[model samples]
Target: MTRPARRIARTAAAGAAVLLALSACSSQGSSAPEASGSSPSSRKLSGTVTVFAAASLKESFTALGRQFERQHPGTRVTFSFGGSDTLAASITAGAPADVFAAASTRTMALVTDREDAAGTPVTFVRNQLEIATLPGNPHKVSSLKDLTRSGLKVVLCDRTVPCGAAAREALDTAGLTLTPASYEQDVKSALTKVELKEADAAVVYRTDVKAAGDKVEGVEFPESATAVNDYPIALLKDAPHTAAAKAFIELVRSPRGLKVLSEAGFLAP
Candidate 1:
């Protein structure tokens, strides 16, 4: 089935459960979310579901995992979140994972091609590049071109990652080029360079900046239109826990999952 159809199906399957959680949270106080990466269930479902996710999805996915646990009591979800390339490499190496959620399809293709994916992958969300800089107009960095300022110390994702590919397209679209002082392996690392004031700015997802929450400010640039990237998730063919993994993927595509991801700044697939 196509990704949109998979999403619709997953939503239909998981929406009611998530909506119940939302309703419960609304009426009662929220308990601390489950340990970092676990599914939620009413009967304390006991099983280990490992997830390989992109570094960019850290905050949002972590929250989702917690909610999953709150909903399904005993399901333990372990996650390895980092650069898509790095995570893909691990899965290819026989890392026992139930689910794979990548920042880009190119990386997911690596696993799927090797018959590592359980089935055809689905695009769950879309993200675009945004420039992150110090709060306020301190540097007067207003556009993509502004990132080329003489004193600016910019950081970018290594070319192997999806964000870097998008950044390349954005720069090419603007008819301007920049020399980043460093190329980090993932968007979070690039954002970290800026957060620590090690670099003057970075190009990353709007959600990354949102995750930072006051740590850094995001500036959307028009050229980002040409550089939008898609996020794809799938169940691993060799997953130790396929049934659980499929359920988690369903949650992500479900209306409840979409609401969470959308609130975190991801565009719906």
Candidate 2:
């Protein structure tokens, strides 16, 4: 091989490398340019969106979520329903979630104060505590004052659940205090005790009172007015589906959403 031939081949290789580098940069430019401090290739908002909602929002949210998925086509809305405080703790601990819908403003504050929320939340609904009694109201219990009667077996939500907090406020407003047989973790469980006929009455959310479907009779007391619970919802700071989270939130504040909540006995915020 001649020296000139060897030099010509080396020059050709260098030129080819330059062309490849330019081609790669051009390809990168075709996609959305990454913002400063971000990765070169950004992502699209699609796939699953996880929502951690309060247990009381279960029936209404489950229906709305299906509608949300239908509207978004490829996107899915997955929900984890539980006590709002429990959900908040899970989110703060790095659970993969896109949104948080709480039964109480106090619970929402826990997430927001931690800077876990993306934006200020909006009030979606209001709830008040009610007396959930056995079918047919056998004991003739009518008010928070009635539950204080010694003979009745009563169950109430633990202070951790929003309903319990509201219950305490209602009792305080009425100038009454209650001693329950047990403090259930959530309204559903407390109501379940009534449904199963385990307890004569349980203090649970008004929506839960309705969802019980005649299995329990709801007794609304005047003092519940002072203990109205505001339901707040918001998108998380690290939402995996910000758009969908915003959409779901919009749905909750929409007429359709309000109707679902209202029919379930939630009051307008």
Candidate 3:
């Protein structure tokens, strides 16, 4: 071959080698994320997630909220804990909340029926009624009928609240008629009466009694089996932080969330 032709052939081969090297580097750069198990398109959650939950969920939900915040940097979780009925009413009244966790299906319906829930609520846990009394059995209240004894002060949650409704159901199952000293708006309030020694006993949730630790004593009645309440959670239709709210709900339904709730004395659904 001629020297000029040989020089041209060598130059062409060098240029092709350079092009191939550049192409290999570009391919490796594009696949680096996949190789490292990282997602380039995954969204970074930020802002606050406002959760309106039943008072009974305070302990478990608070722990779950902290876990969520840690998993998602720059995100915050704030909670509004109250009676399911009241929280449902607030959600229906256009109260700004990212999520709602109710203690009963009936209360959850109040929000679902009004189209305030973004989707069908999921029942994550169940709770049963228990008689909460003073640290010791000062009244010897061993059974549901014991609360009916004359002069024994007892408190009950209002009929509108899930705990109140469950208490009534338990009473009906036992075929007993006993009036309470006062009807409180929530289970926590009723439990508070017993904790303060103002009432001899109060019909509240097993979870609440457990949460109270030694502050109160819990008595399980057989009738409570018939009055177990299912707890449901949902994302709000008008959630300001839609993505973050959904993520938080996912965490609540996850196994880790269930573990936290189970530790808090809540039964799995």
Candidate 4:
């Protein structure tokens, strides 16, 4: 081979190697995370959030949970819906929950007092008690006094739960004392009695009656204003998924969250 030809070939090979190296460097830099200017907090999150919410929140919270999962793919939301007092007890007893959403401030105090809550509790919504009777008002039940009618099988929540306490407050405000055929441990259970026709009526949250659809009828009483329960939510100190828990709380306090709860008949706090 001639010297001139060899020199030309060597120069061309060097130029090609330099170009390939420069291209590889540019590709590596582009592949690094944060290239899009997204902060850690704004990045997509994935994990499981276990929420302990009140029985009255089952319908609304379930919807919010599904929305949260959709907004943050690869995330799971597991809920334990029941009496607020019962849920507070579970959290105080060290249950593995990321968030606690109670139907009343009293129940939330139980967690906050024990330092189980990560921060100060915030009131998200308020709920009022209502008389749930058979659909179509078959018995003509209309007011709080109607619940005291003789031969009416009425059910009330156990006094330990928020709904029960609210019912008692409403009854006291109306100056009426009536006996219930059964005392249910939770609002859902009390509502179930009327839904199943086992009881003629039940004093439960307005949201419960709304959730029952056409299965039960709701009667509004003026006394309900005196016994409105404030719902408070907080993050747990020992949350297994802290970031996911925070995100879930933010979603619950967001405008979309309030819209879902309001549509279910819950009053704004």
Candidate 5:
């Protein structure tokens, strides 16, 4: 073999090795944009998210909030659970909430109408009314009509709240006029009455009864079919923790959130 031919062959091999190295570097750089913070999920969200959710969502939302805080180590989730109407009023009055989750669209509208919501509300779950009675249903209350029995210390949600509206619709469907002994401000209050055995029964959401666990028994009534509450959640306008609030909302609509909610006796919308 000639000297020139040998030198040419050696140079060609070196150039090919350099090209392969450059190609490998380029391939790795293009495949992992996440290292450059291109993925939102890759970012660690830091800040507190103030959430105003319906009374019925206290348990499930609390679970999701903790999960969110765990996923974002530096983040904190604060919640104010109450009647949807009361929450709506607070939001409209400029409450410091990053997100709002209402039990009914009507209450959600109060926020959206006032431009307090960042966007159109999304329905996350549906709830049906159930008669929450003493453990084992000692009163033997099987239907809505039973709630109207004389001398039965029954408590009902205020007519302004979502649960109360649903109870009204259910009673209307059954053609029954129930005169509850007291009208509670929220579903939790009404359910609490039954849990403490202070009231014979209360018309509340099935999820409420489930949250109460063995403390109370849930009785499904056919009239509940006429009134199903749709829960809508949305991020608020100009949230202090905009990114965290958005992330929280996404988590609630995610499969993980759905699993927690389903186990609480809430139906998917």
Candidate 6:
């Protein structure tokens, strides 16, 4: 071959090699982000996820919150447990919260109606009312009607809260009514009354009674079936940590979340 032809061929081969190297480098650079970005684990969540939940969900949601924080290394889960109505009011009053888990659909409506909820609330669990009496056969509270006994010092959640509302429904279904000695703001507060022996019996959730363990004895009634409360959860409209909030809610609706809630005596939704 002629020298000029050979030189031209050598230069062209070198140029091709350089272009191939550049192309390979470009491919690696472009694909790296796409590959990593597509992975679920690669989307790490950070910041605090503040959850406002019903008083009845204290135990199960706390377990789920810990699980969420463990799954997301840089994330933290904070909870504010109270009456569903109070939580709903707080959310509507510009409270900064990532999530809201209410004990009843009616209470959840308070938030959704005000446009404080980011999406439609999903019911995760259902709870029923039970008569929580002091340990032993002190009261022998056998039925919902028994709670209406004249001398029984009964406490009830206020008519506004989910637990209170459920109790009211159950009482109404039984065609009976008894004035409570005191009306508490939340289920925990009403349960606390019995736990502390301040009241002979209190109408509270089965879950709360289970949580109370030996502190209070649970007496189930047939009327509870008609008044079961459906617990719903949702993301708030003005969440500070949107990503973390979504992850937390996903964890709550996952299989593990159901397991924890089931163990807490919460029935499936």
Which ten residues in a row are the worst by lDDT in model 5?
34-43
User: What's the CA error at residue 176 for candidate 6, in Å?
Assistant: 0.3
**What C-alpha RMSD separates each model from the true structure?**
16.5, 9.9, 5.0, 7.4, 3.9, 4.3
Off by over 4 Å in 6: 1-42
What is the per-residue lDDT of model 2 for residues 1-269, given as tens digits with 9 covering 90 to 100?
A: 79999999999999999999999999888664444434211223367889999999999999998987777777788899988999999999989898899999999999999999998998989988788999999999988899999989999888987988988888888889789999988778898999999999998888898888989898888898898899999989998777667777877788999998899889999
Residue pairs whose backbone atoms clash in candidate 6: none
lDDT of 5 at 69: 90
Q: What is the Å distance of residue 120 in model 1 from its true position?
A: 0.5
Candidate 4's C-alpha lDDT?
0.92
Query: Per-residue lDDT for 19-122 in model 6, tens only?
Result: 99999999989988897666332477899999999999999989888888888898999999998899899899999999999999999999999999898899
> Cα miss at 174, model 5 (Å)?
0.8
Task: List lDDT for all candidates, in order.
Answer: 0.86, 0.87, 0.92, 0.92, 0.91, 0.90
Candidate 1 residue spans exceeding 4 A from truth: 1-45
Steric collisions counted per model: 12, 0, 0, 0, 0, 0
How well does each candidate superpose onto the true structure, as a TM-score? 0.82, 0.82, 0.85, 0.85, 0.86, 0.86
Residues 57-84 of candidate 3 have per-residue lDDT tens digits of 9999999999988998999999999999
- Expressed as tens digits, the lDDT of each residue in 114-232 for candidate 4 is 99999899999999988999999798988999989999999999999999999998899989998999999899999999989999999999999999999999998999999999999
For candidate 3, the per-residue lDDT at 60 reads 92
Model 4, backbone clash pairs (residues 3+ apart or across chains), number: 0
lDDT of 5 by residue, 118-193 (tens): 9889999999989989998888998888888888899999999999998998888889998888999999999988
